[model samples]
Target: MNFFKIKTSWSNAEFILIKLCMASAYILVGSYFHDFFAEYYSILIGIFIITAIWFVYQWLKKMKTHSDLPY
Candidate 1:
């Protein structure tokens, strides 16, 4: 399944707000996981950081989107 093909009814700000909410929820759950399995903390943090960077990149790219239609 392609993720980019999925359409959302939310505007950019709403979408960013939802993303922040989801990121915080993941951090909360991830902290619990880290507490129980401390050995994997580095890997878990690495993945989280990478995913956060990817999200920011996608958001920036989306914001920079432009139309080439004649004015």
Candidate 2:
């Protein structure tokens, strides 16, 4: 399913909680599956790190969002 297909009715608090949960899940899953992608894991991790940093910057710097926080 696509990200847009997910239903998130909660406000900012819920949004933050969801993000934290997703990040934690990523870390846990990656650690457990490290052996499966020993070489490709670095690329995956770099992309994840870049995406996460971009997300953080957008969230922290954005004062007024025309759409929702997730968008």
Best by TM-score: 1
* Clashes by residue pair, model 2: none
lDDT of 2 by residue, 1-71 (tens): 69888986777876898899999999999899988989897798899999999999898677556455675
Please list the residue runs of candidate 1 whose C-alpha ends up more than 4 Å from where it truly belongs after superposition. 1-35, 66-71
List where candidate 2 sits over 4 angstroms from the true fold: 1-11, 42-71
Best by lDDT: 2
Q: How many backbone clashes does candidate 2 have?
A: 0
Model 2 residue 57 CA deviation in Å: 16
Q: How much lDDT does each candidate structure score? A: 0.85, 0.86
My TM-score estimates for the predictions, one after another, are 0.46, 0.41
> What CA root-mean-square deviation does each model show from the true structure?
6.4, 7.6
Q: What is the lDDT of candidate 2?
A: 0.86
